[model samples]
Target chain A: MTERWKRTLVAAALGLALLLPGGGIARADSWQDRVSAGSAAATARGTTIEIAMLDRVTGQYRDNGPAAHTRIESASVMKVFIAEHVLHQRDLGKKAVTQTDLADMSRMLRASENAPANRLWVAYGANGIIADIKARYGLTETGPTSNTRYWGNTMITAHDMVVFYQRLMDGSGGLSARSRDWIVEQLRQSVEWGDGGRQFFGLRDGLPREQVISQKQGWMCCVNGHIYRHTSGYAGPDNRFIVVVLTREPSGRGGAHIEASITAAVRAMFPEGLVPRVQGQIGEMWVRSGGHRGPLGLPNTDEIPVRGGAVQYFQGGGAYWSPATGPHWVIGSILQRYRAMGYETGRLGYPTSDEIALPGGALSRFQGGYVYWSPATGAHAVMQPILAAYAAQKWETGRLRYPTSGEIALPGGGVMNRFQGGHVYWSSRTGAHWVIGSILGVYKAQGYQAGPLGYPLTDEVALAGGAVSHFEGGSVYWSPGRGAHALRGALLEAYQAQGAERGSLGYPVSDAYAAADGTRMDFQGGSLTVPSASSTTTTTAPPAAPAPGAPTGAGTATAPVAPSDGAATGGDAQP
Target chain B: MRPLRPAVAAALVLLAATGCTDAPPAARSDGPAPATSSSSGPAPAPPAGEEEAQALAPLPDGVATGTAVLVYSGLGELREPFAGQCSHDGSTTRIEGTADTARIVLEVTPDGARIDLDDGGVRSSSELSAGRYEVSGGHLSLRADMTQDGESTGTAELEIDCGG
Candidate 1:
């Protein structure tokens, strides 16, 4: 096997170097020629390797090597046959299969544990099951050694092993479906055993993770002073073929060579050895992240090329593997956020969608809480409440527009966000509500609840030509034609007596523009002049007292010159 | 309504029509704009003396003016929104504004009102950021750096609103 491997490597190298010289004429080198050329060196050293292959799909097969038909020591490969025979007995109710027996079968096939093989050999009537296997499977060269208790020393040829595998795969040869399935399932989980259990050599190591190989390996030292290392398996994405390689290493230095030789031989025979290696950084990442061992498991297909990088599909959300920054998982609303942020290289970077389950709903962290989307909210951010308030009053869309800022915490535990339309204030008490248009402007000028009027007690209620929001100490009344104003104390009573926005005095124009008498609150038609303390009288006059200074009329409007004692009522309280 | 000064008003009409915030600087210096202007023909020279060149007439009473919005590159660079009234306080014009919690300053000279945009490093106008503006009657268009494939790469904008 070692000699054959060296020759194949040399020939493969020659095939490449000969490519340019023999540019047009294709060299059709048969598998036999390749094998024969590779075996010359092994023949000189008296080491012979035998191989038998069965194409389960086409039902055609081939066998080669000096000992191809010669019976040799079976080693642990006999365990596979033993396991099959026991399963058949269990199926026919000749012997009941226990959970412990199944566990032993796993240990035997996977780790090549000997105790389970011996126990099953005894339990299933050893030689009787062996004879049954030989007669039913038509395995001409398979039989126990002279030592009746030793199943490891059972003799078998490569051809007989291939025939046995074929029957096991086809669910024939006197075995039930449950028996074949049990045997194959155990064989598929073969772990590294010899060489301190770190060696995943032979056919298993040679193939990539995408291909499924179910094989039993045999290794024993000093059998007639010859080292035996052999691997026989059914492998392919669909387990479409069976291969048996038997090796007798007298010198003990060529186990790896034989494995490599068999790997190359199978590649030459099958053509598609394994799925083509996935390319790029994402591919490299997949391999690094435990290829088939991680939660994502094996790639079902090749790395699919994408916008910035590539993706390999798996059972879970496949790794958005990349070379640049990270190869992370993307799932759920977090996935929506990542896509909105432009996928991998976007501001959110690679989506590490580690969804920490929140008390209600889930949050996938990203580059920005700047844009958060709840299924209930769609994608709207702050300030919609403010716009919705104005919108209710027929404010034109985008006419009263964009938000000036994100929601900010107010002094009294309420939250306020300003927008082109107006402002939205949210409290645990009043929920989220809006204040906009002229009424909003008046509310803002009155130090926004820190003034004579405290936090809003009610949503704006519409009047004839305007809207009004009642506050802790006052009411902000607004009219389109007259603008917004705060009417409190004597001023509010006078304004209420005259009606409201549709009153004889009209909507309050300025908040409280100061007058010489004291503080004068204006209206579209007149003014409510709260007299100085010395006079103690409130007078009503036409809007001609103090000068209307600027368009945004500057005023020291002191809501009747009284310091309002309204509580900071919006703090977590129901308004 | 307050009456606008005749001289300043005429210049303002052209400035407003063109959205010419960086006009005087571009017109005076041998920058990218001046070179392009010179390439079209010869750029018009400035008024002779520096003081005369810098001198600007007082804005009409009750009229709102310029706002200073800053622009800078690199990490940790702050940007305050341009919002408030651009007022003249005798020799030096002090225009203070606020956007949300951000304090904005509009630095005005006789030549024009401009916010000192700190670009952080040496960069041409082509490498600078695009800015947003809310001006009364001016068309303020901002351009930013383009990538190797001719796609714009910078995220920050150079906002300059000449509205009070």
Candidate 2:
């Protein structure tokens, strides 16, 4: 067989494997298949239904067709927007909600009462409420009717409705926690009959009784010879999923017929009468982990299958499961670091252990490495040689401290990881070594591994006053009075000729700077100047015109200049 | 498809007994009513007798009060009567009433009359066939064919007097 055909066959096999239990990845086509079936059922009923659902956990959004984006009159669904706005205002202290107002709001939501809605609509400025709701929720295809008298005519799309519900439930819709809870509570308390008519249809009736749902229903008739029926809400375990279904049928059909069609569509979409699953071992673990209140929080997504295992996300963390490893929860910063490293797909692979707290931070061991996090350094993964070097320093409690950055690859085939105190750079040639303190600063100023200094040949060594470190291209020296500076090429030879740090030149106080003629370096005892060509060196005393080939204000060198080719000219004058 | 002649003859006999002129209701109260009549037919003519005497007879004045009964038998069955009032301003007679959740209004003239009815969530309006009318002893009654929502239902009758 051709290579392409062979690859396709293997891929098909793997896809089938993922469908089996203990397959870590989620079924990608489940929602799509259900949506297609539901759409067909709705069409067969002679009604057009638009559906949009969002799995808050996985952040997966699904729509059956273009109807999801199509605008339809909101009918009584607009009342929810009005209620949210009013409650939001009350939360902001802009509106004082009295007992009467609350009662009316409850009646408005519970029974779909028109009188209360009418009162609130006029009081709140009908169009203004819709505009605020649209803007706050980022509803692209929603707007108030031109005639404010008809609040029910506000236009909305199924997709936008789902987004609104998600945000409202997820605490991102700008409603205070109390307000959101109140609104959700009201929706949950919805009765079978509303002030306008019977409304206990759609998602509420279609889904199983075991599935808890907080919903809003809307219906209106005889507009453009069509009747509108809409049902939307949060559903499933912990209300982790948002479902919105909007439909319009010919006005000649009775409300009961239209309502039944909507219910049929919903039933088709969830034949098993459930939203995304959160049951089995994962459900038990979620409960043990404190469910919605735990560090893992509520499941944001259904259990998703990955290679060899399945993973599920929660509000605060994630849960990973494998047949070999069972199920474990990774929380907080460690979880974030794992995700950044591509979760199980990356080198870190699946986590092998839950977070283990150390003296200064916490860590989670993964198949490939360990992610460590501390209040001071956030989180970073340490692997292989670097990890060994970190262990040598005693981890977070050691001198190296917690890692502040993950392994960063250098231009050449080397890797470097940053820590609170210093860095551990690793390569095949250099293995792994720590660079710390002032000596490490001078090394970094030269561009770390990519700079002319290349890799560090040795760790910092103690001197009489300070320390020094040697690099591939040169060495950096430090002293109590001179800080640190790099010396290389002819400059290094000249410094050695003058007895190096113990000589009259002492330790380099500043790196090389560009002279009018060549390069110059300042030291504690004196300055070294190298002319670019064979030129006469004249030393002019204090505040005098600079030498013909000398740079003006040359002693305050901030950075190293490229080494000149000419021979060095030593000077005894202090800078 | 009831014959129109019989209804017209009954109206003429009532007019002759009341000793009232065959002038349009609007002409007596304010100004002449429009020449248009209900789809049913035109009003009946008076017998040629005592025209001068009929002209000398005093015309009914001011507002008339009464009760209106409506029987609907289309989609469902409903029978209701509303205490009502009517006023004449030479050009036309406007009658209105409300009972329970239903309301009705009839605008009448010598040529024709139209009715607007709102009841049991159904709102409809249609013209009424030219009806027989009697005015005597401070009492007036009108019986006319009725239709609702564009479908013929039955008939509506009103009996009242010019008490106030």
Candidate 3:
């Protein structure tokens, strides 16, 4: 076979190599033949750990067979099915994306929003997501169901996962080749879960970055005695090798053993197995052995206790509370929240129910605790484990939308930062001192977070932003700025203010931030937000530029608003 | 298909004459020009960088990448290598459909153009040429081509507003 085809075969071999419970690289026969005999591997494992792989080069499929139908929870793997179904419509010209559609899909794929996936499900049902895969790429066994038995009802077997990946690669996923490439790219780019639920240990475990592995994992404490760990991913230069693993019982702590086993098996199957492994994304043994963890005898990471069944049990209404801290659903401290989310370390922004002091011993209210999900809006739980957003939505639930205001106890003393509009306000006890930032959806600032998060608005703070008010950065900074009304009113003022310009782009784009001497900062990949502190900043983009056009700047000067959240405006849908 | 080539070649010549100096880009984001009717055929591409040069511009909301679905007129017929100084006298148009709305504009210059949509927000642009252009609901059929036709080259089924 040609080198290209041979490499494809090698990648596929690695995915299936791990199917054998005790079968390390040396023992597994030609990986192709072994994988082709999917049913053998199904019964081959002690506990029946069936793994299926797809070779994108050829439309042919490999399934560990009926074992894939035992119907494991689809978990986040469902997101792939949803994406395929949606893209299929896009390719067939059966649907047009709305602003909401893009945003929803983005959250589903990038953030793995469960509710949003459901919304898209209406149009792209299993028949659609699955049928498209089968029709286009000849994918079989990866079917869609209204719900799964596992976490939040999204489940599929190891065999099915491979089938889905197969469909994604060969146009059977229902998306155009270009769309398939995009989906693969997004899955590959993901390092950690946007929702903090990335417990799957397959790809990140035993691979190299150059040979990026795109995968997702699902974990839930099963009542049946097994802590299930299900995962699926694509590996390769062109994402030719697809692997899926669904475990009946998981190893202790974070299911790392399951991941390690898969990783060890995959590692041996490639490079060392006479597969002319490309230099890309290969496991570097020295790197693995080179480093030691931390001074505390703990791996360089903090030993944050894992609240295992918190989201799993309470995903149905999980309440969280520490022994010392009583009766609270979320962990209040920012740093503590990250630890709660399984991160030994993370950025700040966790909410503690107890009052704690800030950088300067200021007491700020931090309530606004609530679990919000909307088929209309994505799911969000702004309380503990640090205020993180989830891929949830308001289906039959009420649209309280983040209780609006609340208070939290900080560490060490009185309080930390005040909270409002999705930001922490550093305020002195005196009313005169306060700094709020990156407010959600530009509403008039509610004066200051005097009351709690859900404080009833007597008359709606004379806030800024909306069809009317227009402010530069995210905060109210100057008079030259258009009032919320000015923004929505005349075309001139409207043209000057850029709204939603600073939200996170799924990827980087051409951005120009002016420096002190008019030296514009132009770089790639990093995201920039208007300092919640700035007022007179201006950004210029072509309101009339067309395709195939040369580029530049000149005319009317306008400054656009940056989104408080780190997401771009366009995204995919969950439903 | 071959029978239409001669006419297509002749049409190309005519298009080049009128369209050589000015043409829109591949797709527009500011909606259609004032002169364009709602039912008018797809707009042409305005020149690149023309929008910012013409109007001081607002910071772009974001940049998006897309393939060229259709090239109706003007620059649509040219093979210029991504660099051509173009301004408009109405020979081509750049039309595009976003998540919610469709845009049409003209390239008054290589850097900017006069937009006629609710173009009051931060917007962006791109350059693409390929893919079949399909715009239904209007009356007009034009073939894809090469020869340069003078002024507003390809036949766009635009209604004549004589009252103006």
Candidate 4:
């Protein structure tokens, strides 16, 4: 299996390198080629790929695609859902699933026991299971076949499976950030072992120590003359970016082969810098918050006060995502690329940049989230759409990536290619219509030398739209005012606000005065009062609160916020 | 009502707006009191910042207050019920378990505070742990701890309000 990975990487290295002639920009073909190669070489025959990439940064989905809607089979990946759903219900003031339910899920997922799966299925029943899925999971294409009927032709598709994994990973809904955190801790804390299945190295290989991958494997010896095997889980942070591969009619070592292949294929998308790079080896990690992340890798702090979260960095050491350690961790892991991209750290109130990645393609980028590209081979780039907020730009376009930054030089070219109202105006030496930002698009096609007609889209809305752009060799573009937009989602919000462009909004903008194609967005402060039946657009700036007396150093903030009798309520508790 | 001319009317209107009960008092009720505690910071804010100090005050009929879910995020939600019950009984009051999700125990005294919670019921023995919580209406807040004892064990918060 390891040899297969080496072969693909070696093959890809030679062919893919020249594909992306420019050092930074990636060609989309590279990503697809890597996926195709891993699928073909790693798994012998029937195995297929089912991937669902979420942009946690934007809380939007880049590509649900065909597999997203299909109902194939939950297999072990369903365990994550069961674990999260069971726990969320408990937090929502609903009765906690009985220890019996937990034990059943644990045995089924943590232990890969069919018996416990069956027991829980019977106990929860179809309606019971479906209710939790709908309520806690917000799943669109999933329902129970009944506890008794579970595994009785039980089926789920790769796409729906991805959603389930994502939902399990994201517990922010109806739950505190800490709540979802505990779930992540649980997923990571538990791992399956014994029976030579331990060192399988399928999910373990490829990434760094931060990813405490928790997955389930299934082997089916059909009644007829056939055999099938499947495996799925979050190959990276939060298990939201799920990868599932299934192969039928395989050889004796089918489980191991398929398992290893799926990891490789997905890992190709993760690249090097994407996954949380846990500092130190396992057991030596500095795990914080979710100290009790049993088996699911969800956050759950025991005894110690949960650090309302931490300043996460995509570094090697620390707690959460520090798979080297046990379940003790919380806040988010660091996405080292965030700082490299030039985003100000300690802002956004997030603990780590680990889950943050540069959007992969049009769909992924517009999905509005952060993504990470390996500073190394750049073979893969993992994306996590922001939940509601997004980064319009990487903290910096060029400042050299971390650790190895000292060795390489970053051009620091502004990541954004200026376009007028969705029309390309600057940057890109090639195509008449340039593709920039985290997406690719046909710009106005009008080469401008400057002034009005030359600047047809100068502040004017470009009839063309904008999207997060993806290239042939896996390179992603981040453009806000271009021929790309999120249609309507968090990615659009992020791209417009944090796009790598100099003038992009540093913070998320609530309202935008979008022009014809929406590529042009500006804060009018108030509604744009377009004349009746007229084509011209006019807007008035919203009235601003009179600025407080410019602070003369001794700005005296009254104690309307009284001190907390020494406890220090952080003074937010105004009676 | 007709204004007795522009000048008088302006004065009256200003008085009315500022005088209405919905707004906070326009001026300091009394001069700052001498420091009541060692860490002097304006005499402990006249003890009016948190509503608990007014526990003995009576309310008009039909105007009872309790915490409610005033705002909600689409997939997000948070709720905090005020300390109507706790205020009347000093800094401690046992809830009948409206079964709120914050999973906290509210306590107040003169000095520090203590909050206790075992995320997801995954408890262990440890020393002091840092936590986030809110306290308003003279009631201590459990800073949105998001976990549950998936088993039967419940998590608790120990808050030490001032007025110890």
Off by over 4 Å in 3: A1-28, A32-48, A57-71, A122-139, A143-157, A172-174, A223-226, A250-575, B1-164
List per-prediction Cα lDDT, in the order shown: 0.52, 0.68, 0.36, 0.33
Arrange candidates by TM-score, descending.
2, 1, 4, 3
For each candidate, what's the DockQ? 0.00, 0.01, 0.00, 0.01
CAPRI verdict on model 2?
incorrect
lDDT for A111 (candidate 3): 53
lDDT (10s digit) by residue, model 3, range A237-330: 6576676766554322223333344444344333232112211111111112211111111121111233421111111111222333322222
Write down the TM-score of every candidate. 0.33, 0.41, 0.31, 0.32
Model 3, first chain, TM-score of: 0.37
lDDT of 2 by residue, A313-405 (tens): 877788888777677789888887887889888998877877788887889888888898888778889988888888877877876677878
Winner of 2 and 4 under lDDT: 2
> Tens digit of lDDT per residue, candidate 1, span A13-59?
53333122222113322323333433443444455677665556434
Model number with the top lDDT? 2
* Model 4 score (lDDT): 0.33
DockQ of 4: 0.01
Off by over 4 Å in 1: A1-46, A194-199, A251-575, B1-164
Clashing pairs in model 1? A4-A38, A512-A557, B68-B106, B84-B97, B130-B157, B130-B158, B131-B158
- Grade the docking of candidate 3: incorrect
Worst 10-residue lDDT window, candidate 3 chain A = A278-287
Which scores higher on TM-score, 1 or 3? 1
Model 2 scores a TM of 0.41
